[model samples]
Target: MARQETQCVIHHSKLTSYCNVCGEFVCNLCKQSKYGKHEGHHYMTVTEKTNELKEEISEYQKMITDKSLKPLRENIHEHYLVKSRLDSNCDELTSEVEKREKHFIKEIQRASQKLKNIINGHRLEFSPGLASRIAQLEDKKREIDSLMKTCENVINTGNTYEILEFSKTKKSDLNTTHSSPRQVPKLELHTPRSGSLVGDSFGNIRKSRAIFTDEIKVLKSWSYDMYIENMFTRNDCVWISKTGFFVSVKPKTAEEVERKLCPVHPSGFIVTTSGEIIYSVSNEHCIYKITPALTVRLKHSYPYLPCGLCLAINGGFYVTMHKHGADGKIVHYFNEECADWLEIMCYRKGVSLLKKPIKIVENGNRDLWVVDAASESVIAMNSAGKFKFEYTGSRTCFEPIGICTDSRYNVLISDFGHKMIDILLQDGRFLTSIKLQPLGISRPMGLCVTKDGHLCVGQGNGCVHVLRY
Candidate 1:
């Protein structure tokens, strides 16, 4: 066996420096030597290199721990634990309710028994006398009573025994009638106020929604070449059907109208306010436009790749660019005269430009919403390219894939986690979450609000789910 060399072979000395240029450890003599391989190379002290490596290790550890494991599984496990505890607590509450119910039943039985006893005592005191009076009234009770008293008085003069018997019956009847009127039997029960119960038990549980049904009515389905990419609902449903483009005019009543082959393979598209559609093709710098008159023409040929676009409410249109190796920017084009796109918003503010923008939409405020996939955030900017705000999931961690807004300025974002759609306010406040997994909708990509107040959620692979908003 041969012993391994621990020292640098060239300098015959222990390692002292790390050559950053050559990516190797070297001795102090070799690192500074003019005749060695690492001569004149940028080098760091061994301790410095060790510290740098440690920092890198720390960064990688933090990435895996925080991003991969903690955010991914920790939230799930935490919810599962909470669900378990909630179930246990529910059972305990149910047991407590049963115990209370038994107590209430026993109390009610006792109250009912007391009422029954009072009624029975009333009956014992009144029935016999009432029945005898009714029987005698048929024979004229006033006259009979007078006659009986006279006969009793006459018999008492002759025989005192008959008078004693009549007196005994009369005494009993007088005692019963003269007694204090039986206490009226009345029922009372305690009830809690409805409005105050919610205030006490559930904190901030103000919004209440009644779900009519959980059944997913699978209204329509259409198959395309590859998969459904981007879609928008104007008066009609315009979508990229994998291989080409297609439109469903009356989607609620029909399936699809016709299929058109755009040989360039479109990436994303949007319907303009003037009944015209503008689309972008993959690896193509040209923006194509199609009119309702079925005319196809090239709108503009930019030097950079046009990715996604949205027609603005302010007579202009917003377009996002995807450069080869740089951050993308949204440009507002207002070419009212010809195919020449007049630039309106290209002033990029520092740290405000989108990294890699995908889809674009304009809100009621005429502000542009840019979905930047690289940054994992929906960037909102004013018409003048001023940064408005960034929504990157603060209430719950989610990947924003598709986004849409309703008439009430409610923003709905398709979350890639748990197959859900997150609802947000126009000013970026969390409202609610709509889970679509029950409907078997997965990888929700394209979202649009229809004209008749229905939400069309595109499930990537040529499948669309329609929901009544």
Candidate 2:
């Protein structure tokens, strides 16, 4: 090991000068020695060389401040402004809701008071009439008692004629009858029907309309000679598959870190949650798994040619395959142990489910998404193999090649024919399209979402485009 202080190995002296020709430090003895390597080489004093290098370093510092630091500072300021405006908007919305709530409460109280007044007026109008009717009935009962006393006195005189005379006199009184008592007024209350508060009477929050675009800004890109068939992202590195090779490249410098040779199918491969590389060979009808240590071994063999593969979040995996010589195609789900679990072939008795299922992926909801090239559509099915929906692009010539799902379960499909990527919901509804032609990406094929939520797109022109979508 060498010390921090530079020393000349041959001269056994402290280095004090810089050798320009050899680009190394040298001592005074080494420079002036007759048998020295720097005898004829250009040399300068240590102090002079330090001053000259300081000037160059000053220029580098200026470049860094102007080109990198300036933009970063501006971005920070812009973000601060955005955050301030967002906070202000939130406060304003809350104040508006509070005002509306106050108004609603006032209106309810006013309506209740008005209804109470009407009920009180009805009670006041009926009370007097009811009392007067009771008084008249009591007076009539006293008159009947007086007549009965006069009749009893005549009967006590032991005269049948007097009794008959009393009956005749009371005949008119007996026929008389008090009118029927007035019924208490019925109070039938009416109120508004109960329902959701989001209506004309009560305000509601409206969803912000999405601003669609046909272009996606490219963050960075790397050029290559071989066609990149697929991309799998793990952490900061991206693994791409070409004809007969699987290469892992660091995005920072676009430098190749590792390469493995495998003539994988165009649908390429997938990296499991456990960091295992799973790929398929169409001609051999086989699937291979590679560990993180670069050990490759045969994992499974299929009855038909296996094309595309994907892993589920629940420890299962899925694969799409085509019949050996028939037009029939199918998708198979394998359990956590890599054993066949379910086979999905036809949607019904006569209707087929898939035509040419190529790339496959499982979304956050456990729904399987398959890119069917022959049908020119992306197919979605539930975990139980039930058909969900098929999404054919708006364009007539929809040539979908790459398929991936984002953290939000938004399905992204790369179309080679239109040179665009379609963003869809997990339910197969199209949300928007990202045009790649404008970004100089002609053949957008392989797609993957990085761990940091960035999108990596592989093109047919042997270049991969990294986007911050």
Candidate 3:
């Protein structure tokens, strides 16, 4: 057979140059050269174009394989991270749940033990009456034990259905029946005023003793020449001497007067151990320090309203405020220059101010005793405002207006409406009510127990009455 003649055919419609080595088209003589169109070209017939394309696609199969693997690797890594986070969260939740379960189980066991003790005590006291009830109680106890077991099983299995069934059964068995009547034992008793124990030590008793009676003594009443004007009672006012008193008038003015103290409105007053009179004027919003020679010396101001005043053991005084809903604050003035004093903001740690704190007095133990007039209670706290105890006033008609403490640590509370002075122990126990002999005390406002145990009370009648115990 003769060799077929190879011809070059140009397919211009396809926009492709053909090599003629395999009987395809050649546009120019340069196409025949090995370095030109013939270089690395696999010549093919015109009908083999589709087969050549199929061969070219085989080379790109590996690239497609690599592209498909990228998403699968990324998805696997993301799944691993998510599963790790989920496992950590589940472990934390399981730990918390186990701790809570242990605590609740301990609490329930303690409650069960207490109930058993109570039942045993009842059986010992009334064996005949409790014998029948003890059998029923045992059955209840067994039921509770079974329910607890079910709850434990449910917790271990984490089964909501089992927990719900246990809860329903417990509610039906434990809550449907009425418990037996129990006799509550008495704790304390009181004696009558006949100096005899009237009942068994479990009844309320009235004792023939006085609360603030020891602090009531008569003082020498010497009428001064000064007419009684409007006196502003503050916590810091002090009697400088027998004739001179000092008080603060305003933020800028402090006055010390002889023969008579000026009528400056004050919220509280106190006498220093050295006989200096210091007064806190709430309306003026200032604390004034006065001398014996009728001279104004030191004055200090505060941002809040001032009410109760008491001198601390360190010569610095504490002033309680009347600001409603506000925590009581105490400002301490240490030095004579008024520059070194420290104001402590102690609202959370101390005796909280109730409605309106009216008076404050320091006891021998250095504890601060405050009288809340609005709440009608006497509250006791340490120097730093730590709550100690409280004495509630008489509920029927007693209103504690003025308060003072004696050297013997007795608290004297003056009631304006009842016109009687209630004596209370340092622990807030009621001692006795001292009825005024001269009866017409319209409103008793101020009170002070003298060194000789005389109760000097300031009445609304423009006169201070001295009461003897």
Candidate 4:
């Protein structure tokens, strides 16, 4: 190809040289600095500059041919591929929505048909007149209304993540449900054998109670060597076995369980929001974190033994530990590049709070539930660690040990003395008890409410019982 001649825009003159001072194209006339602010400017002859431009243009064309063009074409094609794949997935999602809608409609229709059959039977046993029939119709109407309300609550109130996460449990329920009218087991509060009027330190008794089942099905059990200390369950059940090894029924992502040495009996563990297991070792005065990759390392070490720990949604770590002298204190720590234990909040010893804090848990509202051993009470405090109310349990919480909160923010305390797990309201009211007598859950040591809403109770024995309410 013929080389195009360059022109200087300012003078409208043929660019016969390169100006070094101004770093721009200039004709020979503009090269004199004293004449036009290009005083004594360095200039290259037109043939030398033309040769340099020709070399640069040659290199640029070679780059486009050999390197840049193929990748640019591939990037353009990749956009098309991604768009096509996303459209296909959108179609699949629409199909899934249709399937879900049909399934719910069929179930609703079947339930309405059952109600119709019941009404027809009631018509045959026509002993009661219009007034009684009207009452029965009103009851049926209420039942239908309640069903609609429950369904709406699940759909509307539940977060997108929780609804998707509970899909597995919902599918299991759907599988068990049939056209036959299934009888739901009635949940009732059993009167304690002592028949004593039970009240907590706060004086607020339970307005609503928890239900327990006599039949405890041990889904899986194993023989362990020592006390099964604490169990955490999310997608699977995790516990430090008696042998000091972490055992899980469903291995998360098939990662090998790392036998990272913690305290022989670690005080407690919090499965972090990121799925890492952070355990507090009372003996070592250290906290260790185990990653999903099965890598265990010392995450943080403290001066005093960290007896219990709870993690907030914002990744703040609240710990209850054994202080050297009187009672242990609650320490709020933030784990950034390192574990920075910000400061000790409440460290006083009185009949009211902070005496040998054994176990600790945080509720939905960030209230701290510290099970104090010496005081024999669960000292609940607000987010600021201010004294809210001390719950000495319904029957003075017998040897309260492990503490955990459910999805509803109800606190579960394992009473070793009473051989029961006492459920309490977050505000320190006594809710109900799970008497471990018949279910073989004696010595309920470690208590945790699973993400799937199952209560995993670790016993003095090696076995951990997973119970549903």
For candidate 2, lDDT tens digit of each residue in 384-404?
456888888879888889888
Tell me the TM-score of each prediction against the true structure: 0.51, 0.54, 0.46, 0.50
Q: What lDDT tens digits, residue by residue, belong to model 3 across residues 422-446?
A: 8777776676777654444556767
Instruction: Tell me the tens digit of each residue's lDDT in model 4 across 295-340.
Output: 4545545556777777754556777867667556776665622344
Would you list the rank order by TM-score, best first? 2, 1, 4, 3
* Model 1 pairs whose backbones collide: none
Model 1: lDDT to the true structure? 0.66
Q: Which candidate number would show the highest lDDT if scored against the true structure?
A: 2
The runs of at least 3 residues in candidate 4 whose Cα sits more than 4 Å from the true structure, single-residue gaps closed, are 1-221, 251-264, 291-303, 336-339, 347-352
Worst 10 residues of 1 by lDDT: 201-210
Candidate 2 least-lDDT 10 residues = 203-212
Deviation from native of the Cα of residue 48 in model 2, angstroms: 31
**Deviation of model 4 at 365, angstroms:** 1.8
Candidate 4, residue 381: CA error in Å? Answer: 0.6
Native RMSD of candidate 1 (Å): 33.4
